[model samples]
Target: MKSKHLILIFLLIVSAKSRAQTNHQTIEVAQVDSKKNNCVEIPSTFSHEILSESKSLNALKSKKIRRVELIYTRYKENADFDQNQLNEDRMSRLNQLLPKLQIDKPEIVWIEQIGATTSTDAKNYFHGFRIYTDVAPVARTYQRTHLNDLANPAVDFLIDNTIGGTFSHPSGTQIHIPANAVIYDNGKPVFGKYTISYSEYRNAAEILFSGLPMEFKDKTGSYLFNSAGMYEIRGTKDGQTLALQKDLSIDFNCTKNEAGVNFYEMNDQTGEWNLLKSDLFSANNPNETPSAKPEIMSANSEQRIKRGVAPDNYETEGSSKVYQQLNLVYGLISSKFGVYNCDQIFRIANKTIISPKYLDVSSKKPIKNQNMICLIDKDVNASFSFGVKQITCNSQGENIFLLFTEDGEIYALKSEKDKRVNLNQKEPEFLMENITNKVKTSDDLKSYLNI
Candidate 1:
């Protein structure tokens, strides 16, 4: 009955669109968001940078063989999730799994973002996750603790997105999901095996959830059964009563079996997902839902991390090493963690700071340095420069500096372009002897010059 109504609703929605007059410009299809328009044409400034980082990170992420970790939750979540490898042991095992499975390691890690509610307060949402690894998607063995709660409500969850294309799922998907019931941390009306249903059976896929309660509003709750054969329960003051603005945590899981492509799962807690087949998906998006791929939501999600830095689904491709360094710093600042240390790699050349005299006279100097430093490539195609207040560089250049102050004053080092040197245990030789203090109050060239 729900499926019939959903189909009718889908038909009605489509019929309404078809009935509209075609003569006028209709918002139904004529709408083009600024982001799409902007993103389509990569900003010239970031064009090279994005492509470069994209290629570099792609190489690292798109290895021929790969293994990935899947984080699942007992607190209902989606089948496919996008997450990164944070644990060193987990990462090593994944790196090794490819060879054992005779398949390439994974280019992406599928996390099963789950919802949690500790026994301490079924009403309160707890930030917790249970991790597992899907060996070439063949089988899954959980890492660390494996706890599935049936009584407590979930506070977090996920959505399995099917990237639309030739490689995507056809018609729909089927999942042979594994779930158990229990109550952790404890207060619930009852504790036993409850039925699990899929949203597809309810026809609620591609829809947004709203009108949720703030916390556990009441002792009783209602389990909403969707057209997809999945049961979604909402805790309320009463079974029939509804609470607006009350946030409820969900514990869920689902499976998606694509024809001829093997099976995959969306773990409810860990946010880790993967393919059950011995294959690597070079073209897969963990964030996009199977039914609808929303661009705005993708942009806003912190889950789309740029490698190890930003959360997967929330970032763009960049140097993973650089991002790792930044992550350490950010972690310390936001969390209770203390100061973080980062490593930087430098590229050296024959000269520490290339002198204009090293080049042949070509009328137009490849690099020009006056007040600020301009480190230009010998070919003059790429250049990087840093200054007192602003940093402007050619699209191909990478700036390795920290902007400590918003005003951009007092650099940790004399910020300049042509800075390809890294300072560590071994310091490269600099032409500092020519660094004559030229702070002349008289404002003369000689007075201002540091010889």
Candidate 2:
């Protein structure tokens, strides 16, 4: 009886151990499957409608996310496309919706996976983000790491809300506000004195430093803007924001009187430029320099003038009628106070897409950690930010490429007029000349780009 009981007990113990091993294997497989399931696939093409329906974005809203891993696959065939720009655009869209969803911003980790040279499955091309709640967050590197250190300071003006008046910048830009035009965000009319902070970006260096998106999209296609000038205006009363109850007249001053330019207002949240109005350019009289003497309604107006609010480079030759004629004044009536641009749509006639390998002049090795790559079309007054692998530009336009490093270094590549790229080579090589020490200021950069 004792031997029989021992045998039964031994069998029971073996059964229990067997069951434990099986359960352990099952749990391991389940964890692997859960990780795979956490990766939500997103569409290859990005749009506002598609973004609204993103599963990953919805997960962010519903769950307590510890971290997010954005996975992008780079295919060999589309190697020349800018993957970083696409990711940035998607992130921008996500950032815009996060506030509305009342979700805290998660730490996003960008991961670039190399796809097979010949991918047969369509799923291989899909990009996505993996959400984690249980796991600890890990450090990750991002590709879109451009630093915007240069900024033009805003010129502040104190204006009476009861009696509105015109304020002018030394750059000849004017803003004409009307009485009782200021209102708070809640539609209450603001009383007493308010301050208007205004800034202007007139050149390539200013535009680049301002970090404004020059690209515009419409139903037809994407286009670049040949900016005549750009301005930012904001109203504040005792540190609280104020808005315009009525349209404020703007006389945007520029050196060039380019025709067919339109007014555009930038969406601050999305960084998208919207077309506001047309017929913006008005020929100014040769004898009149609007910016030469600004009319302000302030007790210290004379002190402001004496301080030389006008930029020295923009000083009009009071003696030369030709110089005054070159000073173009464009008109705009806007009810919104924000960043506005006077720009002409530049349609590339002959588009050339190139993936030029950037090399440092000193070491002759590949440049790493490039913060931003800018291509300025000197002929059309347009600028382009480069993608990770490819840059698209007008084949015949006079172009200059500027590559900014992470450490504030600059490298430049000037293309010869009418022959921007060599079509014969599969991968073109651009030997970038270091211009970091040369460009000390915005004016210096403008001179270097010859814009």
Candidate 3:
């Protein structure tokens, strides 16, 4: 009797334990069904909130409706997700599979721009387009950190962009595309490329963003996709959001007529860019070609060329006469200034001192012993002579100089075209200054002259 009782007790205990295990499994399955599946889901409440917050909807006359349609043609054909799976909790499994995937909620959305373009044509037509996106905050952060890492493909595959990559299942396969390939969000034509591959995917598409119309209240706006798979993006011409202003720092060389300096860029009459030949001053060109290129100094330190004239040969049969006039001016100035340093001499010989001032041959010779100086304009085209209250003037001819005195007498460098020098009749202008009493060394002279 005792043995039989013990056996009965053991079987009862085993039966109860088995029932408990089965109940546990059933509860687990039920819990899985109750929890959410997709990481991001937009319910009707979110849709209503977005509409109200965006203030793009109206109930009055004609309710202009804009919506984002997730053409699920590819998803239905390629994805193996069951109807139940769309609403089931897969975060636990996804977390195990992809440790990098960290975003709490990620959803597909659309960004639209109204009056996004201004016509360069005659009509000045305005156009606009829509952009689709599936980028999440966490995923954006991860991409920044691990741009080149392919180790966690699941992070990019699942949460970042569900519509991207090869979606393979028993039914069919949807090949992953470059973001640029997804140009057409719905039926509207977007401006730039929409590419989303393993390499890079920019969710925002830059169209004619600069000239968006001012009447469009929200020139650029975003809309969330409702769980029902529709996102209404309303864009109206009320008042526009300005496109971002940019301060661009771009570097470019200005057009300069430096005689011997090689100009790499030149514009023609029709405004087409052209480059002068490198061997413009080669010795081979004995024939004076009318199309003869301007002379440029060679790279050689020993050989120097100035305005098509070489150092060894100052005058040639058909060289520029401007050089001859400049040489004459240089000799006169050097003789009066007690010989400038080599650099100053080079600057003068190069015809670099704003163009040489020519004495008006028509005007009568001026009285001698007057305080005067030659002034060259910033532009090398014109020059002049000016009478001043006995102040020194530097001859570099690059910058203008000013002189002031306690007696309220102000003298400035004269840059008018008509002020000419009579090289033959008058002394060199550099020597006319009150040198003995007022002028000092070259430094003091430069300071007084204000080169």
Question: What is the clash count for each candidate, in the order shown?
Answer: 87, 0, 16
Per-residue lDDT over 158-212 for candidate 1, one digit per residue giving the tens place of the 0 to 100 score: 2221211110001121111122221121223223322222221111111111111
Candidate 3, residues 1-451: lDDT per residue as tens digits?
A: 9999999999997676444310000001000111112122222211111111112212211321121111111112225634122211222232233233233222212211121122222122111111112212221222223221321121112212222222111101111222222222233433332222111010010000010000101124311100100000111111221111111110111112122321122111111112222222234322132244333322222333433232433422221211221111010011010101110001222132221222222342322332223333342311222223221223333433322222222233333336533223222332122233333222233345433
Runs in model 1 lying further than 4 Å from the true structure: 1-417, 422-451
The alpha-carbon RMSD values of the candidates against the true structure, listed in the order shown, are 30.3, 14.2, 34.4
Score every model by TM-score. 0.15, 0.63, 0.13
TM-score (C-alpha) between model 2 and the true structure: 0.63
Model 3 per-residue lDDT at 373: 31
Model 1 per-residue lDDT at 138: 10
Each candidate's lDDT (Cα)? 0.22, 0.62, 0.22
Give the clashing pairs for model 2.
Answer: none
Model 2 stretches with alpha carbons more than 4 Å out = 1-126, 129-149, 186-191, 237-239, 281-300, 303-331, 418-426
Candidate 3 has an lDDT of 0.22
- lDDT of model 2 at position 253: 69
Q: Which has the greatest TM-score?
A: 2
Candidate 2 on 30-88: residue-level lDDT in tens?
00111333345444432112354565666656656555555555543466766555665
| Candidate 3 accuracy as TM-score | 0.13
